[model samples]
Target: MDGQHYMERYIQEVVRRLPKGQRVEIALELQEMIQEMLSADGEEVTVESVLLKLGPPKELAKKYRDDRRYLVSPEYFDNYLWVLRIVLLCVGLSVIFSAVVNFFLDPKQAKEAAMELLYLPSGLLAAFGAVTLLFVILERLHVKFEPSQSSPWNPSQLPPLLQKKAVISRSDTVVGLVFIVLFCMLLTFAPQVFSLYLFSDSKELTMIPVFDMEHWNVILPLILASMMIGLVDEVVKLVTGRYCGAVLAVNAVTNLCQVMLSFVVLKMIPFWNPEFFSWLRKKCDIPDLLPYITEEAFSNLFLGLIVFGTALELGTTAYKSLRYGKN
Candidate 1:
């Protein structure tokens, strides 16, 4: 096999697996390696020659795959990051999918299902957050990450709550309860007057079937259940907040449980075109109107949350900034 054929086969395999940037670099490097080997004036560097030198394709692929950050790292990542990766993957996929769905769905379907279906992500956050809690517990039980063995990222720097400090305060518990109740009220009643304004011009509401009474029975319970969940979340946030210790992880769990519950209600209820829900619950899914919520709203809400978490974490940067830096 000529040197050209030798390089072609190796290059093809490398190109197929690598991202374009890395592939270019690796290709250049391999070309250099091939040229150097060919000119060495020892064994003739043919396709067979290079093939014998570079080792098997499988071995090369594994080396390349291991060369960078792994898709799932059982080594060095420690269980916390490992769990985080899974959660992040799930939430990212769901967010993307929901965004796509909302983009195309009729605006009417989006509104009816959007706010109430936050339960999906809430559930995912809960499940993964629990895994994180377990990892924390293991650390408390003296789990060690050995250099020789692959372990989750060391969680020693994690907060006292996450790192086994009894930092959960009575004040946090009370405040969480208060907000949960407040949220319940807001979600359930939602100032129907306000909603009426928001929906006044919506085509879906406007195009309501002339004989719409039948679907009301199916949809109304979903609306009601959502109100109840705000309360549940408040209580959960209070409890999870104190226990999990990692503020973000706790919020994610609290949110995830709601998301799961949202899915259950959306799946079980009749409000979203009873016929469609009926058909989908059996054959597919009555997914929430994920795409309906404006990305702007998501961003704003996420920002607010980050601000709130930071307030708790940093003891109110705004207050400090104002007191020390401002008048």
Candidate 2:
């Protein structure tokens, strides 16, 4: 190959593995170095001989990438792994739950259940990719990972040595915030996606909306408020690293509002799709399923479960606040 062609090819190979922003600059630097090396010989040096002295493209790329090729840098690697594991766990659980639900809803759709399982690996990969991408962005932005940079360290703000149980974990708060954000997005943009669907044909599926959309005018605002409050509370917990009296109070108020809203929404509207049971009966020819699958029964059961869960969460929060308030 001609000297210029050889140099261009060699440079292209080395730069291809580097970050886009640094590729041009690195290439120029490498070209300059090669020219200097050639001129120092006091004779015309062929690109082949210059490259022979410089070594292989892979080794050159490696030298350029030293300490810089990591998707998540050392400062954030632990956090990145932690987030990835949690996200993958959540994704796995979600996939399993969805598969189980689908199986129960339509036992004939065995392929659908299997497909959900098949999706688990892809879901985990996607979660891993997303977490890695986020950490990469943060790494590039030079986010400070040091405790001093994160928040003011106050020895007085620390909980008592005996009250180690009072401390809130930042990781837990972040994971909760992530779940809340995902739920909020689902509720706001794709509420129907949560609904049960029946496969009418190989290529056709019929959806049954889970919630009464007519009551959405009243429900959406309440849901949005509750989710926003939850998100804010989690963010505060993440930032503060410990729950103070003020944080506990805010959390209590938000939980109360959420519980109250849940009750009101359940009372004022039937959440289970009105047509769901009827459609199931007509299409599946399963009369025996009627007694157990009544819409009212399902709605009441769902509401009761929500109330119980909310009340349990509230009680736990209150207990924690009281038990550790002095700390």
Candidate 3:
């Protein structure tokens, strides 16, 4: 290519990689620099020769950005991976659940379920792209997320050191972690597992999922966040091997959030499938055995259980916090 044409290609490559705000100015600067280099060479110069002297367009773009071109810097790379893993795990679980439900919903559609599994790669790619984009934004914004940079620690807040026998059990932590992961997967993917089922003479099982899929977008995220918090709490407990004020505080906060989220979801969405109730009432031979199946009754019961669980957690956390405070 001619000198001007070659320079245009090289500048386009560099400018395209750069942020939009800096593209024009950097392109002009690069052009000027190339011109200076060519003039200083004191000989006929091709664009190829000039670009060759400048190195790869990618590296040249980095230079314009002062070498801040990493999609995720080393400092945030671990966090990026951590977030990516969580996102992928959630997505994978949801996909798996959907596949299983589809298969069970109609055995003849097993092929469709298999086909649905094919979407996993694209789903994962989309999730990865989103997470990487977020990390890239954070990196460009120079957002620091050091846990140690938080409020100063107080020694007085430490819990009483427990005896070796009384320390947190590694097995318990491992089991809890596994349960949390599985719970998140099931909740995200196969929530229908919690639904009521009725078998008919046709040998087909009619299933009614506990929560409406329509509310999934709102409910799942809150539940996932709560599960993540629980996962972190378990990790912390395992690492520390003892309950401390910090642990108690985190547990309490997680419990509180979960309770609030549960209330919000229960209030906003119908928990029991009305169709399931109607089917059961019609198909079942025993009328007196069946309890009332109104939406309000089921919702109130579910909400009560959630509130009770949250209260129990808060009570335990408070007790532990007080014990730690005494120490």
Ten-residue region with minimum lDDT total, candidate 2: 153-162
Q: Write the per-residue lDDT of candidate 2 for residues 109-154, one digit (tens) a residue.
A: 8787767687778867876776677667666866432122244322
What's the lDDT for candidate 3? 0.66
Candidates sorted on lDDT, descending? 3, 2, 1
| Model 3 CA lDDT for position 271 | 48
TM-score, per-candidate, Cα-based: 0.29, 0.47, 0.54
Where model 1 places Cα greater than 4 Å from the true spot, the runs are 18-21, 42-44, 64-117, 123-327
Model 3 segments more than 4 A misplaced: 1-101, 119-161, 280-292, 321-327
lDDT of 3 by residue, 225-261 (tens): 8776676566455434455566676677777777777
> Residue 194 in candidate 3 has what lDDT?
77
The candidate scoring highest on TM-score is: 3
TM-score of 2: 0.47
Model 1 error, position 138 (Å)? 27
Best by lDDT: 3
> In model 1, where is the ten-residue run with the lowest total lDDT?
153-162
